[model samples]
Target: MTQNEPAATTGDQETVALTRPPTALSGDLSPRSSGTVFESAEPPAAASGGEPPEDPPSAPKAAKPPRKRRGLLIGALAVVVVVALGATAVFTIEPVGRVFGIGPSAVPTEPAPDPIDPDFALIPVDHVSAGPTEAGLASALQPSVTAAEVGTLHAVIVDPGTGQSLWGNEADVPATPASTTKILTSAAALLTFPADHTFTTTVVAGPTPGSVILVGGGDPSLTAVPEGTDTLYASNPARISDLAAQVRENAGDIAITEVLVDASRYTGQAIADGWDASDAPSSYGGFIEPLMLDGGRSDPLNDLSQRVGDPALEAGNALAAELGATSVSAVDEAGSPADGEVLGEISSLPLVDLIEAMMLLSDNVAAEMLAREVAIERGAEPSFAGGAASIIEVLGENGFDISQLELSDASGLSNQNLITPNLLGDVLSLAAHPADESDTAVSQQLRPMLTGLAVAGASGKLTDRYPAGASAGRGWVRAKTGSLTAVNGLAGVVTDRDGKLMAFALLSSGTNATVARPALDEVTSALRECGCR
Candidate 1:
């Protein structure tokens, strides 16, 4: 089908990897919020009023052991094994050889002619048994949640195996979700659009000769980088060079003088309401335009590079430069005629890859664009308000409760976004849920969302996190990180010591991100270390 045609519905797609190689966005974003408009209520005090008296306190139990990094523990075990082998060779083996007179009598040994082949495999989880008991999970997590640094919190942990709640604190209360909002945005995109779907950007003949129009198909991954070079959008992105080549080949002997950009596929303000004004041209986010090079970044290779003021116009200029025009200028914003001849066109990487990039980089522009795609597919107006409404509607159709949800933008850059912790946890649970008869079609489509999350201490925004007290979760935890001055959040999945997969969401407010984020990490680390039964 053509790029403008209504796309097919969401269906089973190949599972995507949650982690990816390091990129420019890392270390550039500060873990500070611009402001906190929502003040989350503190955890409630213990049972009050008519509650009965409890029994006397019992004796204190032994202190829990300190957490250990996975890599360090494995190294320590390897050292012990090597020392044991050395001792056996020197003492036990030598003594046995001497007593049996085997040292002199034993036949000489030689290495095998063929080399040993390595074996690699994925061991499936033993899901017949349930994960940690609810009481045990509460015991293991309560202390960490109550720490002062965590501030007012809403959190939940679930065993995805049975979709059971293992622990919770004000989980139903709605609060600012920060970037964890991407979870819902991702889930909706997977449910509404086919996995291999793509957006196209095309160059067509303008109304007059020596003029051409650049029409956007709502693809922000269109890039200005030289062909064959990598940009912040890792998947081989659509290149302006290739688009120009096509236009030049088709428009023979025509000296292109004017270039126009048509970002008509998307409607509404380039910036969302409630978004911080300073963020538009900053590293973390940019104006949400449909046609832009490298997601509107001034430096396509640098994730932290400042964004351009008018991304659509700038894209038109790039095409002008490529066409050898004297100057890049958008002669008309009205758009090309319906009968304009197609000069050239290019398509973005598959939608699945775009979702992966959005999650891995916590990319705001990509998220907004994807959300608009969702809106378009569902027949909602392709705008900030329409995208937000369409996402909530899609999730609701897939069995999630949307009563408490509120959104101003799909990227969660807006401080106005509000989502319950339970809702976030549920979305994650479905994403991580096992494939079986009981699994919903929504679960199958959302599985790719897991692969896009940042791995703790390994990739993306979580590359340097889970330190010290949270070391045990370094490789075991995979989550999406969120931060806005006093707001912080972590939502994703982790496998515990017992090999049981669990999904969790933690949103905090009334505290600085610097302290709350580390505290949140400690909580997930506790989950990784617990074999709570």
Candidate 2:
């Protein structure tokens, strides 16, 4: 729900795979640097020796003022030199040396830390503590979670290492999850599809001569941008113009007259149940058509631009213009000719990239498309009901309890969605589980969701959050945010002050987002700063 604001207040609202760690996914582990850095201080001078008694007559300069005294001074001087050299070593080892507050490297040139590695599998492995006890965590969280702004809170904190809830407050109660519903959709997609899978849009010969049929492949990211232009969704998206070029070349000098659009891949309502019709033409979302350009945006380059009501037909018109056709129309109920010759085809970006983008930007359109893809793959109807049922089915099969879960759409734009904080915590626990501690097949497949989460106050919809009282969680918390009229939710993982990783979920109802959001953030910030053993 944190996407670009829609004009009509309808637009933006926005895995389950189990497998062992695959060799192809391995990478160098880069853990978060632990331990404190302190500046080295000079040892206090030895009592000053009374400042040499104001030069005291040059101390009766006898030939080296006693051999025993001279020997002692030489020994002391040797000790000082050795200590200084060791201190210098501590300061000169670059990043490693900076960890110890000694030596010449004590004063770092840069104050800010380096960015965290984007790979989720490479999370920090060393934990200094066993994690907070339930009592301790409750003590630290009670005040924040119960604040006036956080109405009817349902929350839980879990230690991913053991898959146990350490602290909770009515966490089993169901609440509107808003955009956090993407967690279920994204998980189901990853579980059902290969990471490198792609969707293809194709053009083929129409039934009539000099006519072409454009077949939709359910790829909403397809763009109408010119060859040299940049795209908002994919780095290099499949272009509509390219398809037209292929059509021109294949057809030779034949005069192209009509373009028939085929959107038979998806069935049922173009819009999901409970979604506001005004939302589609605004910036938040659009109809879930099989064929659409720039996610149905009126302006391809502007993410917040209004969307078209008939994206499938709109796509057909674009192709018609490119082919210099005189008329464009949608295929009849019977659909495009089954044996039409393939004229031109383009593939979308890989599933892995699309999922990441969907999570990061809270792309309502992308979420819906991917959800339907999951439904289709699972042999369910490709409608809103089917997509919702498919997500619950896949997650339920993979060992998650769905007794209390309910969904109306993949994107949380629908207010009908209900999810328990405990369930979300369970999903995040699997995602944040350490590889060495848990070898379950499901955990590995869910690992990528960790990287997709927005870093609090640093990335995605959370970029503007975690200010002031909650600033401690800024870069430390990675979460999926959800917000609607009276619903606010956050679910993610964070490393506590003692280096222990914990997954948490907090859902608030009957409160304004502006107030509930900050209160929820404060509670998580408390978790980040807690050493509540």
Per-model C-alpha RMSD:
17.1, 21.4
Can you tell me which runs of candidate 2 are displaced by over 4 Å?
A: 1-124, 127-129, 468-470
Q: In order, how many clashes per candidate?
A: 4, 11
The lDDT values for all models are 0.66, 0.66
lDDT of 1 by residue, 433-455 (tens): 66556766777778667656765
TM-score for each of the candidates:
0.77, 0.76
Which whole-number lDDT from 0 to 100 does residue 115 have in model 1? 13
Indicate the worst ten consecutive residues by lDDT in candidate 1. 73-82
Best by lDDT: 1
Q: Candidate 2: what lDDT?
A: 0.66
The 10 consecutive residues of candidate 2 with the worst lDDT sum are 70-79
The clash number for model 2 is 11
